[model samples]
Target: MTATAEAHATRRRTYGAARLLLTLTALAALFATATPAAHAAEPVAQAAYLAARLRADPVYVTDQLPREIPHSTAPAFARLAKRTGVPTYVLVLPGPSGTGKGLLGAVHDRLGRDGLYVLIDASGVSDATAYGVHAPAADAATVALYELPYDAGPLRSFERFVDVVAQGSEKAAQRAASARERYGDEDPAALYLGPSDRDNQSFLTGVLLTAVPALILLLVPYVRRWRRRLPGAKPGRPGAKPGKPGSAKLDSGRKPESGKPESGKPGPGIRHRLGRGLVPAAALAGAAAIALTASLVFDQTRSSAAPPPTAADLTARVHRVTEGLKRDSVYVDPESARVLSAAQLSRLHDRIRAFARSDGGGPVYVLLVPQLTEDESAGQYDVFTATVHRKLGKDGLYVVADPLGGYIEVLNYGLRLDSVGLDLGLPESIGSGDDQAHEADDHALGDRLDALMTYLDKVPRSDEPNTAADYPATPEPVDSHVLRPLFSGDFRPGLLMGALTALFALALTAGVLGIVGKVLRRRNPAPLPTSTLPFTAPTDPSPSYLRRTAHTELSALAEDFRGSAGSGDSGDSGESGDSGESGESGESTHEQPPSGPSGLLPQVRAWDCFDAAMLLVDGDIDALDSPGPGPETLVAVVVLSRAGRAALRGEVNDLCCGVNPLHGPAVSRHHVRVSAEGRRRRLLPVCESCRNTAIVEPATVHTLLMTLPAPAGADGRVPYIETDGPLTAVPNGIPRLIDKVRETAGVQ
Candidate 1:
């Protein structure tokens, strides 16, 4: 065969390999998309199903409420509802802009509670109107009073109205067989769904919109496969020049001989077919991209087309939410609503203090809003407020209208304001002007935001909650919490984790394709005759090439131990030549990695691990020391760093790890050695030994480690210092411990 034919054969082989890869990549992407579906909406659906189930239960009841509320408010509502036989309505508005709309919605919901299902009809009512209190009509089957903030006097009047209604109903019941009969007939119970509930449907809609496109992208490549075919052309005519059209050519990064269709004689081998398969794979990948793009565009268009929540719907929702407010304990602004006496204020302060202790932080806010009767404008208070500062400035309450929302925003920004802000100083410009003061106040509130920030800093979280957020610098797999001990960052170190995943996939694909490629090559080997093309060019003989590889490897091994690095390098004169070779590259082939003395992992520094390990070794050790473990065991907890944790994890699985494996090469092969005291002793390093006896206080070690970020070695080589001698000889001997064990076990 001519040189052109030989080159054509190589081109065919190259195409086959490319085809296989393209096909595999497309398949893998589809698989990745399908697998995450099980997790999609899993948390939301679970939360929704739980809510629905709770709603269906007889004991499950909800109250309508204002957007902002005190922590101690929920119980008061329940108690008031039980004490008074009138349904309560809570009027909650979105903000200053929607006060009228909010109030009307609250009253509408209140009127509908007498019916069996609490039906609400916002049919004719305009969304933008302040609420009114209406006396029930004379002919109405059951008397119901509509109560809300209608005017300057209505708030105090509403309270009086409630008292009168309660009294009148009791008097009327007195005429009945007994007071129990009256009480039973006028049961005061109502339900409300807050703005959160009203907006949940919208949230669900948004989720569906986001997810549907991803699902469609997953389906594309497979659906379009059959319609796509490889482009084909016939081989050149039999007598035509070798470089004719319909020909294939190959260049091996060297000069190409000529172009020609390699398939002039017979069918290509399996390798050639596999190589050609790349074209189809590439086509499939393109289809996947198009499908994903189209789906995203469609989703965006649909999202844009959807209308906002209707006013009537919102009014009805607000009403249903506010009905429970009547039964709730009323909150009068600290600055206004003078009806709340000194005793009430004192009681409120006590509640605030108790809440602060329970929450493990300072009171975040002491919100004071005037009732409608006091002054309509005083009802609104935001982060930016003069009265907010007046009421809470000295008390250190973080006054914000939407405490939770503001907190969420600060947390999302990765600003841990709460844990670090206690010592922070206030800016001088904060109290300059009313508006400036308010802006400063807003910033201060955000700066001091704690509750949400606390959750992010210490709480173990599932990524699903904030999956859409930017990923951290580290990559960790999402797995079950039960396996959290085993799945640590140290187990799979560094930024390299992201690329490890891709490489794993590539390796798996290559392994699968290699087998397929071999089968195809067997039937149709390379097209050109073997004698026509020389198999070898003068480069290096295979044996000599392997010998050189062995020499390079030996040089690397010798340089593994070097002076001023490790103790093993002192006498190894043979390493100098290899060290020189490594130095020429300006990058060390073997650099010393930081480890504990003798490469032992320091467990004592980790209180949790040390305490746990001690407990595992001997239960009687605590009793031998002061304060037995029965009570003291609670105080001891084991803590471990990432590296130490990795060692502990391996130990749990009965694998060689930490000092046990590392000591052999780092220290002497033998465990027994002489110490500085001139006594024969087992050289159990500080990393492997407990700082105190087997019965050490968990807190003692933990506090010590937390204070010292890194361990102190004799000469900076060790991660931990030897604080105490190893327990080579047990105190009072093995026999004493055996006797104690027998006594505890109740052996005669």
Candidate 2:
């Protein structure tokens, strides 16, 4: 054979191989797009396929987005994975914002290990999932990434995550809660969507809404009047009173000899009247319908619901969305469930993808929503699933997982969901035999799906889609209190509440204004219309300043006595040099009494009462800033001085005021009350000034509050007159105590 012949043969073989490849590709494409109507060309969902590689290695990184997340992150991920205590697997891949949980779940299913699975997307969005692991791996991961700086690297976030999980569940949960509050409960928009904000917005919208109908109704009459005013129109109703304004104007121009003008063309006939009535009626009906629709739409999407569906609502809602489910594989009723988290839904997407393949069974459709209640339509589980299956007409597993219900159910129709492996609904299928090891994550939707997917691998397929289904028993209802929703499909409850709030506020404000206006009208009322101004004439000034001369005089005298005691002598000479005592006690009785303490200084050195009073006056300033040289000290000083001088003059002493010893001398008796004591008034010696004060401003009257009575505990410091304690019985007791002390000193 020649060289050209050989080359031609090689070309022919290459062309044949190319033709076969093209033919196979064309056939595959045709079958994929045409054979299964359910597999309509929709958006292709991305999935995480790291289980095989991760089984061999604890850490895996996809270099698909090499520029975004380099392969070098593997070592860092590995280091952090080892620190999680429970066995840990780490994967770094290009996952968009919300796909973290789903990605990890898919990987976890294939790996089939009880460990903490950490998945980090290239953008540093991540989550940690745990299957039968004794660790707070999930919350730790949630909190750690949330706590780190917004632009932190994936490895760095993972490092913080390891630290959080190591701290244990309590701390991890607390931190997770804190992280939840870092931004807010929901989004920042929720800040503006709070109860108060909702009320305000609802009020404004409600007012605007209410006004629109009113305005339309108001315009109906005007619009009809304007249409009547148009040229060649009936000026007034037929067979109307000719005396009416528009009716008479037409009759005045054309009245005949009888002057009736044919009653304005016999009014309108029955058909015309009926037709006229129908227009307005139709308009009113249309207006009412518009308002109703607007109200319903608002009601449907009001209160940005914070709450998930209730038990009954959940079951009924599943029924409501069955028709929707027929059209689309995924029908997340915006009403019945709390918005499923991005990660969890993405995970459900992964399982759906796995089940959807014929290699397993036909394509699977996983319905993810919060089951409002565990006790569903009794006896309806079998019927409901069958009814849904018949409607769908698909040979695949229908897995329904409610995060709130805490259980996953499978309604297999031709999809061998339970035939090939352990049934997810059966507790014993967990293989641990210990029921507690079964994923008891009843409240966590992600957790329930995670457990379900563990037993759900590639389900074996069958041609004549037969049913092999399992229904989980009704779970005990989970307890949750839903607050005012941030955004909900139901608006009436919040609207009614807001309307009530507006009404209450309006009523309160109006009531207050009315009361205040009435009171103000009686007091500073609007004056009668007068020519002159409603002003007062200028008045002369009369202001007085109280000197409190007694306070200063007593304070000065006490200071002088203190100075003399220290400087003059700490001796009895001040008392021994009395002028009349040695001369003649009888002669001394005839002399006039000295009034102030300075005059009695010669005897003060021997008077124990005077000495004690001086000691009290010199005591330290206290915490309460109470005016010291209290009544007890002041009374003792004045009484002792007066008593000493009286003994010199053979006269009776008049002590200072009993209520307030700061007032000079008590020349009269007055009635008063003491602090915290019974309100009963008492007669006591008081100066003219104190008497006036007790009469006019009784509360300002001071008392000799030296000590508390027995009724008051030792710690209680009720210092009121009449209360018993260590101090003398005020001004009256002072003189008696002084005289007793004088006799004890043998000076009498």
Candidate 3:
């Protein structure tokens, strides 16, 4: 193949390879993103297995509850619990359902009769139950078990119940008695239901966040199109038409009509300027306004509809609960600690301390919170492990459990995670809500702790454990709070507002810059050229013949004009010769030529005019010699022919009317021959009356010359004709006329 083809093939192969690589990269990125998401969706069995390992504790709270309870209500409930001598366990479900009994039973089995189980659905439904073992007998009991009235709703009624119980007086007992009397025994099968206002608001906000920006983007293009179609719209580029602004023909640098009003004004009026400038400004302003408004709306919505806490919040809460943990002991809730006897607490503390001593590091900190979502539980485990890893050495284990949610997450910064036979079963084992049915006499919490310590004891230590001095001192805080939800929870609105504000500021800056640039461009317009030469000619000549021909033609034309000026009525000499040579030409009915200086003066001047015209034509032809002639240049040549004819005819008005020198008697031509020749040339009549009158007017000759056309050669030069040859065959007839004038002047 040719070099060009080979190069094209190489480029095509390169492009194909690049495209393939780009496609593969995009697909790989997509797979990389998708794989983690797929992995994060844990299987039901895996969740159950993990749930089974959780250590049940007193006052089990689910992950669904808010991180902090209301101060007004929590203190009252705690007071009520203290007065009743029963621990209060709160179970906050994601939603109300008829199946709440199963969850309640599980909590009841986990904590036993020592605690009061309170089930509060997210929708504000409440159910408070006191087990028979924990409740006082009818004779001794002053306050009967009561449910919040269905009409009052869970949140309000639950708060009221806490207030009534916290009062601890005869009036409070009477109120509880009155509620029991009025509502009677609460239905065991009744389902808790309430409104999820936050969830609904969040859904609506998300929809608007996506749609508003999209609508604004779509409207911008449509608005621009509408503005363009409006009458008297300003063009995008200078010297362009109103509607067809991007037309290619405008680039030719031809002068376009100024957009000034008809009052002979030099520039556009005030109204026109305003109309042109305001439309774009308005479009930009509108987009910015819409974006700003949407951003504000989104911010408000996000703030109002903050999401529930995730794992990070749970982790932070765990840290708060265990802020001042003692060495050689697991950090347990004070209320849960109350449930354990002094001997049991001592034994538990000893076991933990022994484990810490065995590793010569720190005790394995066990945190058993009430309830946390599965995700939050996991996050808590990570946060606790990281905190322990930083505070203690890496050779430590942090186990966090959510007994209310029936799940446990283990974080082993040490070698325990990689311990042999350390599989803790799937999360489903604990989360299946069947643990209560299989409850054994042994305390589930104690058994789980024992199992954990046993596993830790068997875990092989790292062969190259660093000494105490070698360990990092004053380690950096893990900063688990940074992992908190960015566009959710309490900080969502602030984050959204900040981001939108930045975007708006950037857009405003760009818009202002664009407007300023346009104003500056308008203030200082680019200058346009005055002359219209299609192309510039080079000084050097390729072949000597081209330069010689142009010089000779110009020189000969100058000589012809001088000769024609000196001679008087030289046309008769040429006419007499032609007539004598062809006897039939003398018999024609044609006027005799004027024979004097006055008559010849017109022809002399015409020759002089023709000489100057030829010089310009020769120069133009020379400029186009190398590249061949452009279409515009060729058209300009025809226009020059008409101009030359007009100049000649203006000098001699009666030359054609007085005589018809070239006609023969045998022809008796009925039409004036106006030759239009050369490449791509045609012929047309100059004057029909010339034949009838047997007289040729100067106008006829001028007309014939002006309308004549010529073809440029491949090299852009016209063929050089001899001075005395037929003038009509050449473009503009100036070259041939010059030659004829030279011959006539020589004879004189």
Candidate 4:
């Protein structure tokens, strides 16, 4: 109940303050217009009273002043200061009378407690007819100055600072509600409701801190969604435009593009066909999505707002140093910005002055340029004046700039460098998972360089501005976050934002690629082969009975044809064009036959012969096992007679051997053995071609077939005779043929 009551009271107080501020503003305006110079005195007197009261406060005493005041004015000063407790200085008009001294004494007594010390005893006032007792326009004026750390930036233009406070309060309430939804009725402390103590300083500071992140978050999605809907959305979407300017220009008097079919047309040149393969596109999309999600989840915008150094600012005591040299000024939540206090402000100012005054003050000015929105161009986001330009007079201001494009050029250059990966000693960092983090950092650095260039460019056009240091250099210990890199150090918000942007790009690219890839893969494709090749019979075919008869007949037929052809001419052949024994030659007396068996001879059952030969060679003759030599023990040899060799002399060759009858073996001697050792030899069939000449190998001959007399006067077929022999130097006939067969079978 106490907390709630306190909150309520705070709200009421803010409201009252806002109302009072508004009234004061109205009265001031009225006085300016209606009563003129005479009317300004009341406000001046009121200001003086307020300043006196603020100066006497206990909070301002030891901590602010550290000085003593005259005893005569002590009581009055104390009474006034006790009422306000605000620290402020009252500017009094120089006077020779004791009244002026008394007022100064009273001011000294009250404001002395704080640093709100008065500058009085100025009888040497330069302007004789100033805004004083003489009531004349002059360069100087007596005024009351008060230190109120209430921020009245772009967030709140009116004097109603309370309105800004209210906005923050409302946001806090909403956020609290959101927290409730997510974490249930848990303690608010876990939510990090406000900084340390929920005082005005905490509240204001918290709100300021939260604004930027909130704006970035709220704005980015809005941009993307709006961009997506641009081709489809109605001109006026029937909702309030909010803070957008000239938005109505788009809706009025403009013919919206005709709506296209719901078939969602993508950007120009994007093909409807899905050409990208699934695996690659899907993988890319997944990666992109992950990156995007991470970026969004961890976005922090603070990294984008690091303050730049200025030679003039370093020497100026009128400066305010940022708690962190953070570029971001916006807050993620309003409540976070509401916590700024006068003490904090003063400290910031002192630090800034010290920093600016460290080196000799040159023509330099400090600036608190706020970040621009996404929609605003850099030009539109330019700073209009130096420090507090709109409120305080422009002379001797911080953040001073001439009326030229020099500063803007510098800023743009910095942006460019930051984008292109140049480092300019600025505190910028790449966001985690950000594709363009490096680029952004580069651009920021470029912006600085560009700024320097612009400054150089404008140097000739303007005279050097006055420079002075307002404070001494005093190094102060900063928080780890402040001293660390912009990304993860003190301000992670900026880094997070950068990451999110990169991720969004990745996700978008992936989505697009995925959509296209799926479609493309659906089109042209090379599918896996349907089924495997039909199985072939095994090579070992010597397991059956009926095969022997067929094999013998085929073998006999081959012998008969070869013999008839005279071992040279392609005989009894139908017509396979001109034939010649085109193959390797046998060594010594006999000539080697053509590589292939005679397949075209009519008398020879050619196919049957080949089948039998293959069976014998593959040792599959067992598959045809009937009786006798079983085709396994049988060894066949080609014997070239002298006559048969003559036939091979001409191009019309009938024999497998490349020999002429004239070149045949010397005698009609024939004996062959299967092995060199003469272990196996049998009475095998022999053709007349062999008998015509004595064709015998000396090493192993089991038996010789008698040579047949010249085939019955030339027109007769060569006789076939049986011979006994085992296979000897099995001719180099079929190795190539077997290799082809193996390849077709997919063997190694």
Which one wins on TM-score? 3
lDDT of each: 0.27, 0.46, 0.38, 0.28
Q: Compared with the true structure, what per-residue lDDT tens digits does model 2 show for residues 1-748? A: 6999999999999999999999999999976656233222111122223566777788876532233344545675788788878898877654432252355665576678888877776445367678878888778877765666543556666788888889999989999898878855443222113345544544545444434444444444444554333221222232111121111101001100111223334322443476467656765675567556645644423222212334443344345557677766665533122324455567777766665553545556666443321123322344445545654666666666543333456666665444434344444432222344244422444545555555566344444545554544343222222223323323445445545554565556557656755674443223221112111200110111011221222232332333222222221112212221312221211122234463233433223333333233332112112343333333344344434323322334445556644333466777777565567776777766667778898865544422322242354444434443223455564555555433322344
TM-scores for every candidate against the unseen true structure: 0.19, 0.21, 0.32, 0.19
Best candidate (score: lDDT): 2
Question: What are the RMSDs of all candidates, in order?
Answer: 44.7, 33.9, 30.0, 31.1
> Candidate 1, after superposition: displacement of residue 209 in Å?
20
- Per-residue accuracy of model 3 over 1-748 as CA lDDT, tens digit each: 6999999999999999999999999999987776344433212222222223223433233332342222123333344445444555554343322123345555455434445555554333246666653432221122323444343333443455455545555667567577567667563222221123333434444434433443344444444544433322332322222322111111111111222244543233444475556546664665466556644644322221113344454444444554635443355443221222334446667777787777533546666544332223333445444554564443555565544433455555444234223334323333222365236321245545555566566655655433222222222232321222223443345445544654675566557655755564353221111121111111121343233323322222222222222122211111122211212222222222234453234443343333323323332323423444333223223222322233333444222211111110112223333333322322322223333332545334323222112344334433222112333333333333444433432311
Better of 1 and 3 by lDDT: 3
lDDT for each residue of candidate 1 in 704-741, tens digit (9 for 90 to 100): 21011122333321111121211111122222222333
State each candidate's clash count. Answer: 34, 16, 29, 119
Which stretches of model 1 miss by more than 4 angstroms?
1-342, 346-511, 520-528, 532-748
Displacement of residue 104 (Cα, Å) in model 4 is: 45
Query: Could you arrange the candidates by lDDT from highest to lowest?
Result: 2, 3, 4, 1
